[model samples]
Target chain A: MIAKELFKGTIKTIVLKLLSDQGKMYGYEICQKVKELSDGELMLTEGALYPMLHKMESEGLLKIEKVNIGKRVRKYYKLTRTGKKEFGLKIEEFNNFIQTMKLILNPSINQSI
Target chain B: MGLSDEQVDYIENLLKENGLSYPPLLEDLLDHVCCAVESKMDDGTAFQVAIKEVLNAFGKDGIEKLQVQTLHLLNQKKQLMKRLSLLTLSVLLFTVTYIFAFPIDPPNSSPLKGNAKITAEFGMTFNKLKAQNQFHEGIDFKVPLGTPVYATGNGVVTEIQSKSTGYGHMIVIKHDDHFESLYAHLSEILIQEGEEIKAGQLIAKVGNSGASLSPHLHYEVKKQGKKINPRDYLTP
Candidate 1:
């Protein structure tokens, strides 16, 4: 199992990508989706996920819709236009970082030293 | 296998009892906890056991901590910055008054040999990379590695500490009963704890240590256990 510290920086990127792909997701749904995607290897705790969602909402990257189920209210988060643009920027940056790491970790594959 | 309205009310009441007062956070947590409990009930678990397991998964302080953490993340860069800037302004006013009332005297000496470049100032400033506003307690001098560090006052070395992070390799000196000076992020500590130190005496050497990214000395002065601006005391 991977250490949770390694996942800290990637949490925001993962949330942005998820919202971009899934359109709208509630807190629990995001957790379940992450778990499913990771094949139960990752769990996004409620403590970590809710604060980040609220922070993103305040940052104008995400908008919320409140739906009532019985007596309880569920908040669904969807990406804004800025959020979509941000996802593109972040994904590009992450891909570049991955490529750099790959070159360092596996230099034997490349012809150039 | 869904929770009844009464069961939902019980959970909501529990959240409120734990001091969760924010509306948006309250709503999100309420729904999330209910969903978790309902899913467990569907798998043949009792409602009591299910709710306990759900709250346990939230870790210690549970619902109460969620609201505090959410508010902190939202408030940090915006509202907190505004409040901190106001506080800094008031503190600056007090420091100016204190300086005018009684000037710092002969015990004061420059911590460095000659004119050194200051990389960061002592005051409230916003760090864009960290996305936070911080009150820098000390003045940071941008110097080369292994640069000699001096004691600013006649004092006894009271503490010498070495750590991997945060004020790593630091020394604290007690001066004139009410005043204390600190030097942090050192590559070498040349003085021993409890050793008597004279003004301008060599005590350490600057280096990139602790949470620092570059070689520099973080020097601070405190009066009666409160950190005051060292800029008020240092000579040119």
Candidate 2:
């Protein structure tokens, strides 16, 4: 499981990138996608995911539409135009962060594992 | 089969009291947890164990962090509102005090008697005089110069003099109740030697005649000849 503190900042980016690529996704579907992408390594609890989604929606970064699926009403979230721009910026930042982390984590990586 | 309506209502009320709205996302999350707990119970899991498991999934620090953020925002708004109210109240209080309680002085009690109805009020001080130290003695009320200044309550006129002192023209009324009232920087005097007058009666008018800053009646009251805070006696 990912450390809670370390995950807070990146969660929004993760969600935004997934929605940007997938076009639209409901809550359960997004959770399933994350599980598959992480190869079951990263599991996001509903408690954390829903609040972030709601916050992003409130901020106008995401738009929601409700569809009646069988007996339940499912809410699907899609990225807005502003969300697309933000997604690009976040991806760039994340890439830089990953490179920095890799350098710090394995300074002698060029020599051995 | 699930949590009672009363429990849900209780939780909702708690959130409301904390100035948090019931957003749909939080509602959906709670509903899912409740349903999962119910399912576990149906599968022969103990109620406490199911509840513990569901709460554990939320993570101890996660819920607390979210609550703290919400509460911090609420508290900031509340503090700003409280400060604004206090500022408005202080301005209102100062206005009322300025209108009602003007011209306070030696610092003493008056033996003569008369009533002052506060006609016009303003403030005066020697701030620009470059004196070693200065303080505002009283608020000045404009009535008429030498308009027979009266005692605020029952007090005797203890000191009466006319010279180039701080108060060029002044009258000190001493009261029998160990209180004194002072009227200073006057144009003329109306009452005779040791005479008594009733409250609200004409004593003197506003004047610009003494070490006077402007044309206004300077007034003061004192308990035991000691200047008490005049603001405490004025009515709102």
Fnat for each model: 0.86, 0.04
- Chain B TM-score, model 1, reads 0.54
Error of 2 at A64 (Å): 1.0
lDDT score for residue A15 of model 2:
98
What tens digits encode model 1's per-residue C-alpha lDDT throughout B56-78? 88777867788888989988857
**Chain B TM-scores across candidates:** 0.54, 0.42
| C-alpha lDDT score of every prediction, in listed order | 0.88, 0.65
The most accurate candidate by lDDT is 1
Clashing pairs in 1: none
Identify the leading candidate in terms of TM-score.
Answer: 1
What does DockQ give for each predicted structure? 0.54, 0.12
Model 2 Cα shift for residue B5 (angstroms)? 14
RMSD of 2: 13.6
In the order shown, the chain A TM-scores of the predictions are 0.92, 0.86
Q: At residue B217, give the lDDT of candidate 2.
A: 70
Interface C-alpha root-mean-square deviation, candidates in order: 1.1, 5.8
**Poorest lDDT segment (10 consecutive residues) of candidate 2 chain B:** B105-114
